[model samples]
Target: MRISVIGTGYLGTTHAACMAELGFEVVGLDSDPKKIEQLASGVLPFHEPGLPELLRKHTASGRLRFTTSYAEVGAWADVHFIAVGTPQKAGDHAADMTYVDGATSALAGHITRDCLIVGKSTVPVGTARRLGNLVRESTSGDVKVDLLWNPEFLREGYAVEDTLRPDRLVAGGDSAAAIDLLKLVYAKALKSGTPFISTDLETAELVKAAANAFLATKISFINAFSEVTEHVGGDIRVLADAIGLDNRIGRRFLNAGVGFGGGCLPKDIRALQARVSELGLDRTMRFLSEVDEINLRRRDRVVHLATEILKDLQGRKIAVLGVAFKPHSDDVRDSPALDVAAQLFNAGADVSVFDPEAMENARKRFPRLNYTKSAAEALENSALTILLTEWDEFKELNPTEVGDIVESKAIIDGRNVLHVQDWLDAGWRFESLGRRSV
Candidate 1:
């Protein structure tokens, strides 16, 4: 099968490479010429653990290629997957549908033969039905051009694994042939016991948003409890573990940390709320606003805790460990760690920031903050240290070794991953969120 994936960002690139890995000829399409050139040259612009290997493997074997022209893929491939971004619009919580809309219309116009045009991007509900109509009006009546919404459920850093061995596959389409053709494209996954969900257009679209909203709610729910535990004397981690022991309540996303961020959770929940409000159901998803606020407050809690740790911020050198939203990925969009670093920097604290992989991207976003080579370099001669993102390096950090490098013996475990006794045994002043005050 010949597969063409549009939008060579994280989602599209991973899908294209994985499809090729499944022994299908795949061509990834991106509107940006530079990105296309980079991918074709086997140089991925972003950081994903396993994707780079797959890209190098597929591109070397000639099973996967990239292009900037939609017409090239339009005329060549048996399947077209739209994986463009639907970022939150500026000055609004709603998702910007420009990329998805343009990609659909352009692909619909250039498609010369009967093939399935699958939408893999996360979008507002009812987008598939609307785009399906647009495709019908735009295409000639001669060929059977099928439009299906197959929203991607990829998690960053594990995108390759998720794409190659997805837990489930959901397709929202009206045409049986279109849905069946999609099954062929994902036949490898289906044969491996991946559940296939066939639903109408709206249900498929809502599934992604609803999943994101629930995840965001879960994170915020624990963070809200973290607020209470921070004020009163209690162990938030123990509280989480106690509740997580229940078979009903899972132990994932329950670690009270510096809140959820990245390209998906923050924007998706807000977009879901905005979309519901647009449909005159303002009260339906209003709690998502609270979820958003709770998540943001976790950032503030870090700032306030840092301030309390270092009373005077001006001219104090503070080390910020991990600026990425999370570890194993370089994405800093709406990152709490970056935001807290910026907040500290703005308050006249000299911030030396470092992350395992996100240093370059963080530097691009916030250039003025001091960027360092390693975690030790970021901590060198700093009055206080803040661990925001829970990267494995930071989590398993040797407190005694880190203790000797800092100007002062102070640390804040924003992600609540540090061993309190270990830091204290190392004779360093240590504090973590949702723990008894130091």
Candidate 2:
């Protein structure tokens, strides 16, 4: 099946290329001329492992192309996927549906043949049903059009692997024709044993929201335990391991460290709450407020620890490792690491930041802080060092080498990945979020 994907941001760009890899002729559309030009030139605007090679191969082979015109892809492709972003609305917890609505209307106005329009963007439940009506009303009815909500379950660092080989696939629409067409599109994955979930629109939309809320809750649950462990003399990691040992309570996101932050988790949970409240179910998702509170509190704990260690913040050279929310990708939206680094900078500390891939994006967001070329540069001559994001390079650093660089031998393990005894043996004062400092 031929496919056209809207929005060339993280999700769309990856989907477009992966569709081409699955042997479908694909066209990726974006309103931004700069982004289209970059993608068309085989340059990825963001960091995602294994995506660049796919984009280059497909574009070079003419299986994947990019354009800024909806009319072009409208008459050409049999399916159009809406992979646009649904970022949190400013001054509100609800998702801003402006982009999704605009993309749907644009395609509805221009689609020239019978096709399926898939909603890959996360949204409030019932959005698919609502958008189905909007599509029927907005379209000229020159062709038969079907709508489906196929929520993407892509993790940032592992987006490519997730897309090409998903653990499961969910498609929500009432039309059998639309479902069949989607099955054809994902036939390879289906043949490879990827579970396909067929359901109604609301359930499909809720899956994404519910999944994010649960993951956020899991991370906050462990961090909440870390808070207790921080006050009392108990090992938070050990507590997590003991509980996670249960066959039911798997050790996935139970790490006790700086809490979850990224484009997905923080906004998705808040948006889910706001959506339910709009339906007058205010108290239904009330606990998510505490989830958010716990996540934000993790950042506060880091800043407070930094202040306590430095004694005085003014003019203290502080090294911050890993400004991206997690690792392997350059996304910094609602990133816990970046938030902590920014807070430290605002608190009058000279915060030098380093991330393997996120420095460019981090610099764009917080230009006032120092962006270092390497982790070593950030550590040099610093009074204190903080490891926020758990990148492999940051986790593998030698304690003795880091000890020689920093002016004062003090380090904070924000992610709880380091060996506490090793740092202590290096003659450095070490502190972690849920551990007794030494």
Candidate 3:
């Protein structure tokens, strides 16, 4: 099977490479010449664990290729995956469809025969039907394009694994041909017992947004508990473990700390809320708004804790550990750790920040903040330290050794990953969310 994946960003690039690895001839198209050039040279623009190796393997075998022209993509395949970004629009929470519209229109103009155009980007419900009309109109009735929604659910750090063996596959299109083609394309997973669900276009689009909304809600739900836990002097981690033991309540996304801050969760929730309101369901979006507020408040809580610890943040040397929204990924789109660091700096703290992989991206977002090469370097002579993201390096730090680097042995366990008793035993004053430690 020949497939063309448009827009070689994180989703597009990973999708293209994985499809090629699945024994399909894949062509990746991007408007950015630099991105295309880099991919052509077997270089990936972003950091995804095991992606470089996968891209290299497929590109070297000539099963995967990158191109700058949509004409090539249109002519090269019977199936074209529209994986362009639907970023949150400025001044509004709705997703911007400019990239999606442009990619679909361009693909429509170049195709002369029947083709299946699958949307892999997260979009507002009913976008697929609208785009189908636009494609038919642009093609001047010369080509038949079947629009399908196959929203991607791959997380940044686990993109390759998610693509190769997805939890489930949701496809939606009006035509049986389009649905069957997608089924065949993902037959390996279907054969391996991965649920292959087919529905209408609207349901398929809502499935992606709803899935993200649920994950965001789960994180916020725990963070909300963290708030009450702090007041009641309760250990949220232990509480979460106890509650998660229930068969109905799963353990995933229950970590209570700085909260979720990534490219997907933060934006998708707001976008989903905004979309719901636009559809005349304003009351239904209230819970989502609270979820977003809870997530944002966690950042403020971290900053407030730092201020309280130092008595006065003004002229206080504080170290912030971790900037990425999560570990093992360099993306810092809405990172909670970086958000707290920025708030602290604004509140007059002399903050030094460090992260294993997100420093470069964080630097771009917060150029005014001081960035250190190592966590210990960031903690050097610090009055207070905060572990914002639970990276393995941060988790495995020796309490005694870390205590020696700082002038004041005070630390905030933002993610609750640190051993509070161990730090306390090492003569360090440890403060953490959802727990009592003096």
Candidate 4:
């Protein structure tokens, strides 16, 4: 099948490459000329583990390509996947639908033949139905265009794997042909026993938001208890493990760290809240506000812990071990680690930040803080250190080796990936978010 994936951000780029890997001719489309140029040259504009090699290989093999022209994509492909971003609005909690809307309309106008236009973007419920109407209205009567909501459930670092071998597939539309086409598109995964959910457009739209909201709630629920353990002196990690032993509550997202952040959880929760409010069911999703508050407070707790450990922020040199929201990806959107680093820098501390893959993006987002090329450089002569993101390297740091380079012997395990006794035995004062300092 010939495929065109619009909006060559993380989701689109990964989808296009994976589709090409599936033996399909794929073209990734974007309005951004520079991004298109970069992708066409086999140079990904961002960091995603294992994606660069796939992109380079496919671009070299002539199976996958990129272009900024919707006309080129519309006239060329049998399926068009709308993978545009729906970021939270600047001043409000609602999602900004401008990109998705524009892309759909553009695709509608340029399509020369009947094709499936599937949405992979996370959007407010009712978006597909509305966009479907727009497509119907925009397209010529001679050409048939079916809109399907097939929201993507891709994790950042594992987007390629997630796309090729998804946990399940949720496709929403009334058209039998559209559903079959989608089934054909995902035949490889379907054959491997991956569950495929067929539902109405609204349900499919809500799937992404609901999933994100639940995950965010789970993280916040644990972190809220972390706040309690911080005062009453219990181990949050142990508590999480004990509770996680129950099959009902999974251990994932149970880590009580600087809370959930990235491109999805935070914004999706807020967007869900905003969407429900718009539907006049404002109080239904009200608990998400608490979830949001609890997540933000985790970041604050890290800052407070840092202040307590350092005694003062002024003139102190602090090293932030990771700035990406989580390890294995460089997306710093709503990142707790980066925010903590910036907060400390704002308070007159000399902060050095380092991430395995996010230093450049972190610098672009928060430039005032120092960016270091390596973890050792960031830790060099620092009064205190904070392991904010659970990068493998940061999590596996040798306590004695790290202690030797620091000016002081204090550390904050923001992600709780460190051994308290190990740091303490190395003559370092260690603290983590949910544990009492040792």
Candidate 5:
């Protein structure tokens, strides 16, 4: 089947390349000519593991292409997946639906043949049903344009693997044909016995929101416990392991560090709360407000710890190890690590930052902070060091080697990846979230 994916961002680019790998003719559509040009030449504009190889291979094989014109894709493809971004609105908790709406409307106007329009973007609930009506109203009567919600559940670093081998598939729409088409598109995964969930449009949209909310809640739940352990003098990691052994609470996302932050979790929870409030049932998801607060407070805690350790932040050289929200990806949106670094800088510290892949994006976000070429460069002669995102290189740093470079040997394990005893043995004062300094 011919396929077209709109908005060649993180989700769209990965989906389009994966679709091409499944042996379909795919065209990725975007309004940005520069992004389209980059993809057309098999150059990924962002950092993702294993995606660059796929893009290069597919583009070379003639099965995948990219374009700036929606009209080209609208007339050419049998299925159009809307992978546009639904970023959180500015100064509000609601999702910015401008991209999703604009893409769907453009596709509806330009599609000349019967096709399925699937929504893969994480959006507020009731968006698909509402857009489904928009599709019906906006499309020409000659073509049968239908809408479905098939929200993406891709982890940034593991996006390629997750796309090719998803845990499960969910399709929501009334049309059997639409579901069947999606099944065909995902037939490779189904052949491997991946479970398929067919539900109403609203249920499908909520699956992404609900899953993200649960994860954000899970992270905050543990961090809230971390707050207790911080005061009561207990090991939060051991506590997490004991609770995770229950099987009811899995070990995933139980790592209590600097709290959850990335493109999805923070905004998704806020969006869900905002959505419920707009529906006039504001009390339904009120707990999420606390979840958001706990997450933000973790950042504050790290900054506070730094201040206490340094005994005065002014003119102190601080080294920030990682700025990406999590390791293995360069996305800095709502990144706790980046936010902490910015916070420290604002509080009058000589902050030097380094990330394996995120320094460019981090520089764009916080240009005033000093960006360094490597961890060693950032660590050299610094009074304090903070490990924000737990990248493998940073995690594997030898305490003695790191101590030799730094003027003062004090470290904060923001992601809980460091061996506390090892740092302590190195004669460095070590601190971590939920752990009392010895």
Candidate 6:
């Protein structure tokens, strides 16, 4: 089956490459010439753990290709996946639909035969119906374009694996042909017993937002508990483990630390809230707003904890361990680590930052702050250390070694990835969110 994926960003690039890896001919289209050039040369613009190898493999075998022309994308495939971004709009909580609109309109103008235009981007509910009408109106009846909603649920670090082996597949469309085509396209997963869910377009769109909102809520819920735990001298990590053992709550996003701040969770919840307001559902949006507020307050809480550790922040040498929203990825959009580091820098602290992969992106975002090559380098002679993001390399660092380098031997476990006893045993003062200080 010939498949064309529009937009070569994280979602599109991973989807296009993985589709080819599943033994299908795939063409990835992007308007950005530089991105196209990079993909054409087998160099990925962003960092995804296993994507580069997959891109190289598929491009070398000629099963996957990159192009800048929507005309080529329209003509080359029986199915086209609209995987462009729907970023949060400026000065508002709503998502900017320009990329999705542009990609859909471009595809509509070029398609001359019956094809399924599947949306893989997270969008407001009812977007599929609206885009369906747009496609029909643009195609002038020369071609029949069936709009389908198939929202992507791939996490950043585990994107490739999630795409290839999704826990479940949810597809929504009015047409039986659209359903059958999607089944054929995802035959590998279906055969592997991956549950396939068929729903209406609105439900499918809501699924993506709801999934993200729930994940965001889970993180915030724990962080909220972390707040109370802080006052009551309780350990949140142990509480989370006990609650998670029930198998109902399941400790996925229950880690109490710096709350979620990535490209998806923070913006997606706001977008979802804005969508609810657009639909005249203010109550639903209000609840999500609280979720957002809770998530954001965690950042402030981290900052407040840092201030409490040192009586005054002026002229303190602080080291931030990780800057990416999460580990194993270089995406720093709305990153909690960067937010904390920025707050520290603004408060007259001399902050040094390091990340295994996100240092370059962090440097680009906060050039005024110092960037170090390694974790130890960032901690060198620091008055306090902050573990902002829980990268493996940061988690594996010996508290004793870190204590030996820092002048104050004080550390804040922003992500709750450290052993408090180990730091205390090493003769260092350790502070963590929602946990007893040692």
Collision pairs in model 1: none
Tens digit of lDDT per residue, candidate 1, span 1-438? Answer: 899999999899999999999999999999999999999989999999988899999999999999988788889998999999999999999999999999999898898888889999999998988998998998889887888999889899899999989988999988898888999988989998999999999999999999999999999999999889978888899999999999799889898989999999999998999999999998999999999999998888888888898998999999999999998899999999999999999999999999999988898999999999899999999999999999999989998898889999999999988888899999888888788876
Give me the runs in candidate 4 sitting further than 4 Å from their true place. none
Q: Whole-model Cα lDDT per candidate?
A: 0.92, 0.94, 0.90, 0.93, 0.94, 0.91
Please write out the lDDT profile of model 6 over residues 1-438, one tens digit for every residue.
899999889999999999999999999999899999999999998899999999999999999999999888787799999999999999999999999999999989998777889999999998899999999889966677898999999999999999999999999889988899999999998999999999999999999998999998898899889889989999899999999988989978899988988788989999998889888988866877888888888889888988998879999999999999998889999999999999999999999999988888888888999999888889999999999888888888898777778989888889888877777888888888888777
* TM-score of every candidate relative to the true structure: 0.99, 0.99, 0.98, 0.99, 0.99, 0.98
lDDT ranking, best first: 5, 2, 4, 1, 6, 3
Instruction: List, residue by residue over 43-89, the lDDT tens digit for candidate 2.
Output: 99999999999999999999999999999998989999999989999
Question: Which lDDT tens digits does candidate 3 get at residues 93-175?
Answer: 99898999999998898887678899999998878999989888887576677889999999899999999999999998899
What are the RMSDs of all candidates, in order?
0.8, 0.7, 1.2, 0.7, 0.7, 1.1
lDDT of 5 by residue, 1-438 (tens): 999999999999999999999999999999899999999999999999999999999999999999989789888999999999999999999999999999999888888999999999998989999999988998889998878899899899999999999998888999998899889999999999999999998899889989999999999999999999999999899999999998988888899999988899998999999999999998999999999999999999999999999999999999999999999899999999999999999999999999999999999988999999999999999999999999999989999999899999999999999988888899999999998886
So what's the TM-score on candidate 1? Answer: 0.99
Cα deviation of 276 in candidate 6 (Å)? 0.9
lDDT for model 2: 0.94
lDDT at residue 391 of model 2 (Cα atoms): 95
The RMSD (Cα, Å) of candidate 6 is 1.1
**lDDT against true structure, model 1:** 0.92
Clashing pairs in 3: none
Candidate 6: residue 418 Cα off by (Å): 0.9
